[model samples]
Every structure is written in structure tokens, then in C-alpha cells.
Target: MSAHVFLHLCHEVGTSLEVGTRRDIMDIINTLANQMRTNLMMTSGSRREGFRLVESDLDVMYWPNSYRVIWELYQSHYYNNLSKELILCDGSESRPGFTLLYLLSPRLYSELQRACVRMKNRHYISSSKHRQIKCSAESQRSTLHGPCVGRHHGMLGYDLAHCFASDIWPPSASSWIDRSHSWPPSHIVDDIVKRGCHFVAIGHKLEKHEQNEWRISFSLAEQKLVYAMNHFQFLTYGLLKLILNRIINNGLGDDDKLLCSYHMKTAVFWAIQQNIIPQWCPHNLLYSSLTCFKLILKWVYEGICPNFFIPSNNMFLSNIYGEAQNFLFIRLYELYKMGIQSMLETLSITSCNECIDFIRDPSISSCADEDVLFSEADFDIKLFREVDNQGSFSVSNVQKCIQFLHIIEQMIASPLTQNQDIMLQKLTNSVLQNLAFMLPLNTYTQENKLKYRADKISCHFLKFAAKFGCISDVLYLAMYYYKTFRYTEALAIIEVIKVKLSQPYVMHNFNVDEEMYTEAVGGQSWSTKMGQAVAWNIKLNNNILYISELRPEQQSSLQNDVPYLYIPPFVMLYMLEIFAANM
Candidate 1:
């Protein structure tokens, strides 16, 4: 292909406006949902930032609301006394963008105390101790990777980092404010500064007290900056990551960790901010990518990949020196000399042949259709899992239910596209299902009048959810009826679910019975088919507030930290029918 055609193909494949918008919508919804949780505030990274790369891990940072990190002593006054434990950032001994956290709270919680060590009559939280505790507290299958505890079981493995929230931006990164004048614009910069940063449980590797120091995290700020990027710039960033993972870091062992996704991100940030590429557009996509690559090569050559926020903090201080640095530099230099065509050809030869095919033809092929269906299935499964993962509603209090209702209302009031609307429908279904269970559990009273009213309301909520939910979700309503001693009503819903499951188009997990699905709804729009498609699995979130009735039978499943129980619709239908008959 000619250079013009190749660049156009690259832009078409990587810089998809539709894909970017969908990702933005997903992020907004997730961010809103995460904000409702009181105990731990979760912020999504990587994939949530509008890139739908298959290799991207689900990166999340969560911090408890009870603890607060402050830059200055005076900032403590803004927090309510006894409400939150204050941790002061002491950057004196640590490197720029890393700080020693001094426990400013008069009474340290046992967990905090355990992670703290006294130095000069003041207790400082040990990063190593804190990270150990956090990692150990997670599932045994999780492996510790720097500040994150990673679980590698699902379609998309996730890395969970436990961090401390700082309301004030770190002084070390204060230079970032002045540096963002050209690219991010004043409003974006102001928003990032106001949102501040986090302190993750990993210190500067070269620091003397590395165990007691916390590296400043710009995850939130970085996310904002990414959101601010135009499609061309975003795709350029994605292309760099593709090079890093597929070309640079390919076949490198765990210990041979040299270049990281962050390095690529920092390079992109600097490139955009510095206006190294005068115009970032489809025609200049390859040029932009090469510019970023050149910058990274220079950094690798110098053995100094500077942190974008704090340029003084050399990210390559720990590694990327001597033999490793030389190897990386040579590899990058060879690729650079070979030019963009060589790199594209190299990518085409990789296992991800679909990427090149996608570049060549932007239109959805038959295989792409199947992939899209599977992607939608995965998205739905993830949405279901996130609902279950959020702190469950207590049987005694319906506060969480109320909060979810508020969130649902907010989502409805906002303007949404068809895809987002469908997502909202699914979200509404999940929330209402949980609320249905919670209402019955919390309002169950001996007063016949009140009990009857609550039961009626609960049933109505379940019915509403059933309208928007998958075929399997209707079983929730059936289960609710069975639980309430209304066996006949339950059996009726079970019969409906049985009929729906018999349909050839019903999807289950990632398994796409393509021939059957195509025959059923081949000509229909994706949104139409998506609306009609029913999942085979009846997902009961393993939360006592939602599934208290199932506790007796699901004792083992509940005891473990599994988010949801995926029972086949047929099995649930039959089981509920048998139970209703016996009753």
C-alpha cells in the first residue's frame, strides 16, 4: 500500500471515533457507579480510558474513605475531627514524586499501626509492610506486582492497587500545572489540580527508606489528560503501547522488565504537551507515532525516562541501565531505522493478524460480527460482576438501595445514545433486582398490612427489572415469588423463562453459537439483536442482602469471595418449578 493509504488505514483502525465515544460513555457510567460506594472509592485505569485493546488489564486504584493524606499541616483543619485519619506527606527524605507518610492521627488504627515504624518519635507508614498487608488480604491466587495485587483468572485480568487519597496535589508535581498551558488547556489543568493525586504503596527503589515511602500516583490526573486528548493523539498513544507490548517487551521475562506502558504514556504526554508534532491528524498519524518513538529512544539512550509530572524523578533510575538499557536502545533504534512500513509489516506478522485486517478494512466482516457479539457478552458479564463487587446492601438498612436509585435517576436524566441507553437498561435491571431482594428482607414484618404492601412493591420492582433484563434475570422474579410463598406466581415466571431459554438465539458466557444466532437475527441491527438476546445464566450476586434466601443451598459459594453464582436458566427454572410444586 502507498504511504497515504497506509496512514489512512492506520487512522481508520486505531483512531475510531465510534469506539472512543463508547469507551467514554462506559467510563462515565462506571465512574458514577463507583462514586456511590462509601467505604472504598474505585477509579478505573487503562481499558476504561477509551482504549478497548484485548491485552489491556483492568487497572483499578481504590482507597478507603476513612483515611486522608494531606500535603500540609494546615490542610488537616478542613477534615472533620475523628471522622478521618490524617496522614501527612513527608517528602524530605524521599525522591521527587515519592513521600514518607507520617501518621498524624492521635490514635492509629490497628491495621495502620501494624504498617507503621517509629523514627524520631514519629511513626511513618512502611510501604513494604502496607503492600504486604494489602496483598495478603486479597485472594491467594493474586500475585503482587509493584503496588498492585493482580488476579489473572478472567477474560480480562485485573490489577487492584490499594492507595491513600490526597486532596492536595503533591508539590513535586506542581510544575505540571505550569507545563500544561499549551495542550490540556486551563480548565482541564484546573480540574486535574483540584482533583489532586494519590499515594500508592510503592516507594522510590533507590531511596534509603524505600519501605516507608509512597510514590505519588497521577492515575486520576493522567486519566483526565487522556480524556482531553483528540482521537488522533489517543490513537497515537495506543499505537505506542502496541509497539511496547508486541515489539519491545515481547518475549522478555518477568525479571527482564525494562519498558512499561507508563513509559509509553509519559512519552505521548510530553510529545503532545511540547507540540513536537505540529498537527496531529489522520494524515500525520504515522509521523506522530514515529516522533513519540524517537523521543522514547532518546530517553532510553540517556537512561533517563523522566516522569511527566515531576521531570526530576527519573523513572529509569531503578532499571533501564547498562545491558538492559543498551539492549532496549538498540532494539528501538533498529525499528526506527526500518521505518513505519517495516513496523506495520512486523505487526501484521504477529499473532494479532486481526489488527492488520482491521486496518486494511474498517468495515465489519463476518468474523468481526462474531467478535462484536462476544465483546458485548463480555461487557455485560463485566457490568454484572461490578454490581456484585460493589459493597452489598445490608439487610437492616436500605441506604445502598436508595443510593443506587439516585444514581439510576441521574443516568436517566442525562442524554444517552442507543448503546448507552441499553447499558442503562441493564444497570437499572441489576439495581432493581437488588432493591427487590433488599425491600423484602428489610421490611419483612408481622404486621399483615405493611407486609402485604412491601411484598407487592418488591414484586413490582422485580417485574420492571424483568422487562429490561435478560431471560435468565426473569428467574430472579420467580425466585422472589417462591421466597414469598407465592409458588403459583413463581411457577408461571419459571415457565416463561423455560420457553425463552429454548430459543436458539440465547447467549451464554462468551460462547457464540454463530450459525444459530445469525439465522435468528442476521439482518437486524446490533442494538435490536442485543435488546432481544437473552443470557442463559441466572446470575445471583453472592450478597446476603440480595440472595439471603439462597444462603442455605449456596453456603460454600457464599463463604468464598466469588462475586456471583452463574446457574443455567434451565437448571434454575426446573429447580424453582420443583420447589414450587413441593411447596
Candidate 2:
């Protein structure tokens, strides 16, 4: 096979355009979901950057909506008389890529005040103190790792970095605008700069008052740049990451972190911007990878890995220098000399021989048949699981649900692609179900006539929910009927639920018989498959609106730390059936 064909095969094995599209869609869905919450707005980081690598970690940066950071004193005028607390970024006392956040607002949140230390008549938020406060509030399982609060155990282990949003672009990174030149285009640059940046609670390693300084994060800009990359560029980036994880960092202890994935990204970014390769195409893919690796090796040798935005900020100063840097340089240099073939061989893709065979024969398909299907199923399962976990009936929850419903309505009224329409329907289903369970709670304290009217309205909402919700969602209506002493009506619903649960394709608690599911609903639309899904557990919010019979169970759950009680669907159904029989 020619080198061009080999590179194309590598692209096929390493990257999926379909997966990238789905990831972008998932990011939008997550962004919409985060908008409903008042406390924090989340932006997904590395994991959602259109990559399907197994080594990718779930990196999320979330900032409070009530706080805003300004890069300059003059920029504060933009938020004059606003309710949000203003924080000024003061880089005079810090490094190039980091600044001390000075609290400009006289009225500060108590938590923010606690994280502030007065120095020279200015109160600066201490990154260390802020991290300490955040860690204290988190569960025991969570530990502070640099700026992020990392939880190591989960379906997808995540690193949550609590950051502050800044609407003004930093002056230090102004040079990046003109530096783009031919690549990324002017529109992409403009959009990225307009979106601004975030300040994470990490200081430059060499800063004297590290705790008082915050690092300016260009994660938003980087994400935009990644999105703007062509397929070949993206595949090359993915390939670099694979090499970083599988080749360079392999068997290295945690303390020996001389090189990181960020270095690889920066190398690629520079390579693209400098036009190191005249063309980025399948034929030139190996050349592209080689150029990036060469750049990284040179940076390591020089002991200066420049930050993409701020060139003066050396990323290698803290860890990648001296003896460590020399060792990394030698290792990378050896690999660079061995060339692209060595790097390709080190990739942990399934069966090297199979990849080689596929490359030799043009007729052999290199793509996985079930890649798209599995990706869709995975996305749906995770999204729905999040909905299930957060389901609650409270005053605040009701308000959020109402807001989310309004957003969904607005989105539905606009023009949408097929995937977007399906996404909105799933969101609508979740919000409607939340409203159904929550809206009637207020009527419990009202007069009998009002309560009767509320019960009727609640039933109507439940019916609407059942249309879009999973199969077990109807059980909410049955539970409501049983609560109202309508045993016959509840029993009828229970019988129907039993029959549905008996189906081999039914999924519950994030578990499904794979063969049965694939045979039954694998080819169906997400909405269609979800309509047949079953809720894993019946969640009852800790509220006084529960039926008298269930109050004991609710009270027991309240004694624990959690704000809700989780009853398996079958368990709840059996208990309700027995109670109805006796009643």
C-alpha cells in the first residue's frame, strides 16, 4: 500500500466523523441543560472536544452565574448597576497567564468573602482558600487536584474545576489575534475572542503568592479552534493524544509528569498556525504528525513550551525542565528518529495485524459497523441517567423546570435539524415529568376545592409526560391514583406496567440485556427506544406532600444525607398493589 493509502487507513481506524458530529450535538444538549440551573453554568472540557478516545477524562469547568470577572477597570462600566458581583483581574502582581482577582463589589457573597484576603487595601480572592472552601463542601470521595476537584470513581471519572467567567478578553493574549494569519480564519478568531475566557483557581508554579493568583484559561477559545479544524487536522490531533497516552506517558508514575496532553495540543496548534506543512490531507497525515512531534521535541530540548495564548508563559517551567526535561527530550527524540511508523505501531487500537491488513486491501472496510449505533445508545443512556438522578419536586426545582420548558418551547418554534429535534423532545419529556410531580405540591396547603382542582391538573400533566417519558413513567399516574384512594384505576395501570416490564428489550437502572436490546430496538430512533425504557428507581422528593402511608419511608430517607428516597420500580409497584388490595 502507498503511504497515502496507509495514512487514510490510519484516519479511518483512529477517527470517526460521525462520532465527532454526535459529540458536538451532545455538547449543545449539555449546555442547554446547564442553562436551567441558577447556581452554576458548566462547560465541558477535554472529553467533549469531538474525540472518542478511551483515555479521555471528563473535564468540566463550572462558574457561578452570580459572579463576573473583568479584565480591566474600564470594563467594569459594562456591568454598571448590575446584580452580579464584579471581580477585577489584576495581573500586575502575577505571571503572564495568571492574575489576582480583586473583589470590586462592596457587597460580596459570604463564601466569596471568606475566600478573600485583604492586601494593600484590596481584597483578592485566594485561589488556595477558594479551593479549600470548595473541597470542604464536596463529598469525602472528592479531593482537590490542582484547580480541579477530582472524583476518581464513576462510570466516567470527572475533574470539576470551579472557575469564574470573564467577558473581557485578556490583553496579554491580544497577540494571538494577529498570530492566526492563514489558519483558523478571521471569523473563527473573532467568535473566540468575543466569547471571552475563564479564570481557574490555579496559579503559575513560579508565582510568589501562588494562592492569591488565578490562571487565565483559554479553554473556550481552544474548543472553538478545535471545532474549526478540518478532518485531517483533527485526526492528527487525536493521533498525538494517542501517542501521548500510549507511547510517551506509558508506565510513567504520577510524579514523573514531564509531558502532558496539553503540550501535544499546543504543538499541533503551533504547527497548524505556522503552516509547517503546506497541506493537511490524508496523504500528508503522517507528515503532519511528524511535524508536531518535532516541534514538541524542540520545545522540550529548549525547556520552553509556550502557552498557545501567551507565549511568555512557559508551560514547561514547573515540571518539564532540567533532568526531567532532558529525559523526555531523549525519549521523544528517539521516537522522532524512528519516525511515524513507530508511533503508529504503538497505538492501542484493536489488533495491529487487522489494521495492517485493512491498509493493504482497499476493498476491506476499516470502520466498525456498530460505532454509530453504540455511540447513540451511550449518549442516550448517559443523558437519561442524568435526568433520572436529578429528578426532584421542590420549589426551586419547579422554577427551573418552568424555565427549561420555556427554553424548549422557544427552541421547538425555531428551525431545527433532525438530531436537534430529537434532543429537544427528550429534554421536553424530562422537564414535563418534573413539572407533573412538582406543580401539585403547592396545592397541598390550599383549600379542599383548590386541592381537588390541582389534583386534576397534575393528572393531566402526568398523562402528557407519559407520552414522551419512559414506560415506567406511567407508574407516577398509578401512584397518584393510589394516593387518591382510586385503587381500581391504579391497579389497571399496574397490570399494564407488569406486561411492559416482561418484554425482553426493557431497560432499567442503566442495564439491559444487550442481545435482546439490539434485536428489539437497536435500529429504532432514540425517542422510540426511550419511550419503551423503564425507570431504574422511583424517586420521592423529601417533601410534606407525600401520602400518609409513605411518610414513614420518606422520613427514614430524610434521616440520611440525601434529599430523596429511591425505591425500585418493582418494589414500589408490589407495595402499592398490596396496599390497594387491603384498602
Candidate 3:
């Protein structure tokens, strides 16, 4: 490579090193090997095989292929070069080729990630069955296992230098990164934060003559600047994240998290000035990702993080959901989806979908129509009031709430039964038969809310839920909304209630005629006595229907100690109407 041409490549990759810079560094590194006599033959290609260092990125192919030499090169000279650092690649084994894939700048990376996702899900409809049924005189698997299913295994993006700074790959356990290259930049700090200490110091140490001459204005906060200087090798792409991981995992300081975040945030600002980052990662997508990475972590993991620049979890999700929604980055979207799914399933939260749907919806915005949002400000104010009364919330609390919404939506969309749906249904039915006469109690506080004021809360949320197409919360919330209205809210609630009453539930009903009607022996409010009667019927006939309650010994009073009967809110309401009509 000519001296001028090398400078051009360096410029294209947005770094200071000219062509000779890398060769000088490499020749020295090769000399470090005890057996430096081995001839070094280098071939570069763009194809995803062998070893090719794209643009100015440094990648070299080794004969008698082993990863150990590359590791040695990385461990020895990666920090020293201050030019091209390592971003590992898992080379193709059968093809016997290596390629250095330059990390795409942010917008491009985000764009590519999205493209890959669409590619991944192109066949979902044909891939998944709507429902399953056993074979009708067909051999099971034709004496062969069914074809393996294809799944989407996505890509990770990082800064080359950041990735290669470590001895081993960061996010090794969580990130399915290729191990051949040597650099890393975690867009989300926590993604690689657990491995922070390992890469704490990786930068070009100033030479004696240059030490005094290198007047560094140093923009990022001290900690961020320090971490970024080392991790990013004075690059912008992955500095913020590397710094954040250190703060979060190692603790930025003994007492002050804000101060720590400020320090890092300032460092990012300074790094931006040093390198537009756009040249290497246009749109600063890595930074954008890192910007919300903390919230993304919180949204996905449901916890506050040191990376978020603030420790509060209150609006962390709202902020994260906005970024994920705005960027619509597949990597982020998938994380949020997974997070939401886990959160709701684990928390068993059945409400809040309206809020989630609203937030996740690309159309609605709490920030947009100030008049509308402000008119709704009182609602937020009230919500804050409620927030205030509750104990201080941490990151996990928000995760639980967000997860609850996600799970409810998923269940409504896709109901699963054990390993086998048909077989599971039979088991579910048998359990119903085995444990009837028990009324289920609310497990989460929201479930109790389903019991206590299922009407009001449901009514407020019903329309919005339906608009967002979240039928689960819509139907469930509408039931309570209808039940609790003062004549008007009640009437309004019930109007929508009719549409959702028959959607679906475990204890589905049919005509109850002479077979079900029994002469009543005692005076009871129809709903109460009906509850008890139904409870008894389920216990005797459908054993799986259950309600939990205080044991008689633990009861505050005998009269108040009746075992609760539990049913889906919609189901309970449906039964209540049946009794009224019968009466």
C-alpha cells in the first residue's frame, strides 16, 4: 500500500493512523513471538471467509489455523497501536477462510439489523401452526424426526477497538459474538458491564517526547474520559458504554452515581468532538443505542442501571419504550419484546396493557399533544400521587409492570398448554375436575384490584385498550369498568362489556336448564349465593375451578371467612348476568 493510499484508508475508517502505522505495529507484534522466523503471508478479502481486514481495520490470517495467535496479537499490541483494534470474527471452518467485517456505523448497523429481522421472520405464518391436532391415521414422523425449525440468530454491533481491548471477549456468556476478532463496544453498558474490569486500561500510552506535547482538552467527564480513552482508544463509537459498564459493575464512586454519570456523559461529548463517530458509524447509532441502553436494559431487564445517566426507574421504561419505538431497531425491539414477555409472565400481571400499548404504539405520544397530554396531566399527576403513596420503586418494579402488560398480550395472542396443547387441555380439564369448589384469590395487587374495583379501573382503561387492539386487558378491564360505574360509568362500561363477554374463559357456559336449577334453601343475595352455589358445582363437577381463602382458624370472623370463588373477571361477570336473568 502506498503512503498516500494508506492515509486514505485510515481516513475512510476515521482514525489517525496512516498505512505504515499498522504494519509497523504488526511487524513489532510478530517479532514478539518466540518463533519469529515463520514467514508471514497475508491475504485480504471482503468475502466472509479466511481473514481479511476491511478498510483500515486490522485482521490477519494465520496458517495452521488457531485462535491463540490472534489472542496473543490482541493481548500484546491492541492497546499499543492506537489505530486499528480487534473486533473478533468466527471464521468459517469448512470454507477455511477468514474475513474482517468492519463494524457498520450506527444508522447502517441499525438498518442492517432491521433488514436481518425481516429476513428472519419472513415465514412465520407458514412456520407456526394455528392449532395442533393429532394425526388421523398418519405415521408419527414417518419413522423420522420432524424437520428442525429455523430460528433467527441475530448480529451484535460494537466498536472495533472496544471489542479487541480485552483479553477475552466481553459479554462472552450473553453475547453470541464471533471470537476471531478482538474488539467490543456494548451499546448497552450492562450487556458487557459484567466484564468491565477486564478492559479497564487500553489506550495508546503517549511516548516520552509526545507526552508533554499532547495537550488533551479532555471533554468527557473524568471517569467517562478515562474509560473511553482506554476502551475506545480515543474513538467515539463505544466509549460511553464501556465507561457505563465500569460504573455500573464496579461502582463509579462510593456515594455519587449522578456525579459518575455526569462524568461519563461529559466524556461522550468530548469524544464526539474528537471523532464525529459519524465517519465510522454514521448517525452515531452506537451512541444512540448507548444513550438509551441503560433504559433499554431497565426495560428489558426491569431494573435501574448506572448506564442510564440517572438511577430512577419511574420514567426509565417510558423513556426506553420511546427510544425502542422511535429507533425501531430490531436488536432493541427484540430485547424489549423479550423483557416484556418475561416481566408479565413472572409477575403474573394482567393489567397495564393499555398503558403499554399506548406507549409502544408508534402513533401515540405522552409528549406530543401538550394540550391533550396536559389535559391528561391531571391523570399523570394522579398517577404520581399513587406512585408517591407506594414505596420507592426501583428498576425491577418498572420491569414487573412492563412485563405484566407484555405477558397478558402474549397470552391473549398465543395460549400455550404444556408440551402438547391437545394433551395439555385434557390435563387442564382433569385438574378442573379434581379441584373444583375452590375460588381463586388475586395473587398480584392488580389481581386484587381486579376483584376490588375491577369496574372503575377497567372502565378508564377499556377504550384505550381496545383502540390499541389489546383485547385481553380491554375485555378484562371493561368488565370491572362496567361493574363499578355509578349508573352512567356503569352503563357506559356495560355497553362495551357486551362485546367482550363471550371472548374466552376456562369455565365456559352453555344453557343451564332443569338439570342445573336446584331449589334454594336459604336467602342469599343472588350473586353471593350464586357464587357459593357455583363454587360447590365446580368443586363437585369441575374440580379444577378453585378459590383461595384464609383457613377457618385464620379467619378474622366466621361470617367474613367465606372461601373466595375465583373466575376470570369476564367469566365471573358473565355468570353474574346469568343469575340476574334467572332471578
Candidate 4:
């Protein structure tokens, strides 16, 4: 096939991105149609049926109903059967492999690479050249997707060794603690494992040994300490809060719990003794400067210091960049604790409307969702059993089981219902147990729910030991700025989060169901306008937005790239509306 024909075909099949600007639509058709027409294997004697599939179809070959992969080769001008030709020409035929060989089969894999190659010049190819080849190769060599740096963004078939290694709690060092070697116990590991790692251990070629990237020198307490002792106290707090959320959402153990509470106190101790509250954390940062500036900013702006934007992870903000969630940062821990406390008291008091009046804290009173946790004279037996089992079981020790149930219940009661199976039944059977407890006072069966609650509280405490990442501050600050009409400030904060926190958050919630959004939206009833506004304002002033949409775009350029543009659309609409409304 002629080179010109191949180039023409690529124009037709490729997106505007793949085709250079100069080529028009007709050029696309001529190149692709002619190249295939000209290929001897593709041409049947006097005439032949056309190339098998359309451009829209992915390039996977099949045997009737099933997919089949085989190896074959072709030459530019030769029409002879390749097997006999191979003996005559020897390896010197130096022929290119034309994927068109599949055309004879009932189902043919799309030969995208071959078609693209046929086009004129080597450099004219799209950025995705390395990514598109669909075959397994040598262990060290991989398809050319950019380097995986963020806590998120692993290539296809990604894996993290420590994720399910049973040694998750107590580590072998090389397996669990190191960021390069292990992943935090969030959805990231689970997702990577599901994607399949085959065997992704780091290897060395030199005779002399070097440190393994996976090996962690820092203890969990030290990791937490570093979190708390950082320049941004809010970050320490945020980390604590996130860990708490993970504990509550999943489950934690005694060691994990100790890490949570201890790190917080340790952090508080270090910060106070050092007098380390900053006036503000510039949109960019390190540890010490952050705390000093942030504390000072609060004092200057509010005329008084908060007890500290501190909380167990269970009670942290929702979205790190959500405007409505900003209010959450201020006293969210208190509200969450109170919610737990109230749920506990409800179990203790067996009272309903009666409990609402008793919440002394202002934050507790403000949370509308608090009421939703307990309602219905009718108790759900199945849900109760699930919660009970998940909360406290020694052989099973459903640590955060109780808190997880509450979250699940909240998720179920919330917008997550818009989607399917946000929470799995397997999870339900474990965490949510004893439906008798949630039943009405008169109908109660279980005398005490403390075991479940205690286990959950314990687990919530453990999650603190895990590294608390940066999004906590972003959430806190973004929410604060948005609530106060400080749109520009919020945007700036989100940029910092994208730079640092995004990968961590993605790792943590990697396998999380989209249903959580439904839960957050459904149960939490977050305003679409507010969500969008917070998202966009951060985009414009900060020059960071559309990260989701830009994923495919940024991926190809990652070697030389830093994400500068790409904010969520929701943010754009919301900001514009808010700005317009005020004007």
C-alpha cells in the first residue's frame, strides 16, 4: 500500500486530535479507503468484500463470537501468500505486519496501528502511539502511558503489594509503609489489584544493592506526627479527620485507633509547644508556615481562635473543595462526634425527638442529617444486625462496623439510592447486625448496643495512624472561602490540593462506588448550584479547573506537564450564578 493512502486513512478514522489541522475530511477517506483497497491480502483476486469493521468499533479480533489473537506479517507491495514468501525472501522481506490478516476471519480485530502507520510521516502520529498497542510485552517494557505519580492514576493492570497482604496493620516495612511500595488501605489498592499487577515489584539491575522504594523508615505514629507537626495544623487536623472517615467508612483496629488519637494529641502538643499557628498558609506550602499562617488568619479574620479545626476522621468535611462543606470544616468534628454521641444516647435513652433537644453543641444542632440517622418507629431488623455485627465482633471484631453502618445508613437514606448497590450485602451482613436494637423502645430486643459502638469508635480511632494527606485543608479552606464569598481564595486553595492532595484522595477512595455521590447528594442533599459554584470559582481565580475533563488531555503530556487548567463544570456554573446573583 502507498504511504499517501495510509496517511489519508488515518485522517478519516482519527479524531481532530489525531489528524493534523491541515488535513480535511476527504483526505481522511481517500488515505484509509485506498490503502486497504491496495493491500493484496485485503484485495480478493478481481474484487473483494470491504475491510471488516467501522472506525467506531474497537480493534479487537474474534473467532465468530469469541476474540482471537494471532501473529502475522505483510509487505507494502507484495500480494503473494506470506508463508511460501517467507522461505523465498528470508527475513529480508522486512515486511510490516498488516492487521488486515483478520479480515478473512468472520470477525476481525481493528488494525488501528497499521492504518495509522500507513500515513505519511513518523512524527505526524498522535500522542497516544504508545498507549494504543493492544498486546502483552516483556516485563520491564510497558505501553507508553505517562509515569504514574499521583496517589491516583496507575496504568491499566496497576497493583500495590501491601493492599491485601494481611500484614496491612503490622508491616514488613517494604510491603506496606512506603508510598512507592505500598498504598494506604483505601480503594486505591483494591482497584489496582482488580486491574491486575501480574508482578509489579521494583527491580534493580546493578550488582550493588540500594534502598527499596517500598521500605518505610517512619513509624505510623511518626507519620501521623509529621502530619500534625507540619506547617499547617489544619492539615494535621484534616489528616486526622480523613483517617477517622476511613475508619468509620470501613473499619479500624486498636493499634489503628491509638494512632488516630495519639497523633492528634501529639500534633497538638507539638504545635502548641512550638507556638506554631500561622496567620495563613499561602496557596503553596510546607509544614510550619502553614499552621502559623492559618491560625493567624483565623484570629485576624474572626477575632478569635477556634479550639482548632480538629476532629477524629469520622467527622471530617465531605468534599475538600465543596463550598457547602466548608461549614463542615469549622465544627464538623463536633457535629460528627455528636451524631455518634446522639446515636449512642439514642441507644442508651431509647428516645427520639427527646434526643435532639439535648445536643448542647451548636454544630450538632445545625446538622439536619443528624435527625435522619434515627427515625421511624419501625426498626429495620436486617440493618440493625448488620450494624451490630460490623460494629463489635471479637473473632470478627467489626471495629468501625457501627460507624460504617451509620455511614451506610446515611448513604442509603441519601442520594446514593439514585444508583445501585452502593453498599454490598457482604458488608451489610458484617457491620450491620441485630435489627432488634434500632427497633422502637417497646420493641427492643438487645439490651446493649455498646459493643458495636465501642468497636466502631475504636476503629475510628485507629485510622488516625494512616497518613493523613492534604485534601483536609483544601476542603476546610475551600468551604470557608465559598461560604464567606471569598471565591478567589477558595480557587487558590483547590489548586494547592490538586498539586498535592488529589492523588492521595483518589487512592483512598479508589474503589468507592459512584453511589457515594448519590448518597452524598441524596442523603446529604448537597445543592447542585453550590457544588458547581465552589468548583468553578476555584477554577477561574486559581486557574485550576476541569481536572476530570482534562484527564485524557493531561495524561499524554504528563512528562512535561503540570495541571494548570481543567476545573469541574459544576464549579463554573455555580460561580457564575453566585456572582451574577450578588451583582
Reference-based TM-score of each model: 0.79, 0.79, 0.18, 0.17
lDDT of 1 by residue, 512-555 (tens): 56667667756665344544564646656565434344676556
Candidate 2 lDDT, 31-136, residue by residue in tens: 5767666766555555667664677766778798888898777777787557788888788878789899988865655678999889879888999999989988
Residue 451 of model 2, lDDT score: 73
Off by over 4 Å in 4: 1-200, 203-227, 230-583
Off by over 4 Å in 1: 1-18, 21-35, 74-85, 108-110, 151-156, 348-399, 410-421, 435-454, 481-491, 494-536, 544-561, 568-583
> What order do candidates take by TM-score, descending?
1, 2, 3, 4
Counted clashes in each candidate structure: 1, 0, 55, 75
lDDT (10s digit) by residue, model 3, range 341-451: 232222211124543454345364332111222222222222222211111111123233344344333433454322122222222222222221122323324456544
Q: Candidates' lDDT values, in order?
A: 0.72, 0.73, 0.27, 0.27
Q: In model 2, what is the error at residue 84, expressed in angstroms?
A: 5.0
- lDDT by residue (27-69, candidate 4, tens digit) is 2222222332222111110001111112111111111111112
Model 2 residue 247 CA deviation in Å: 3.2
lDDT score for candidate 1 against the true structure = 0.72
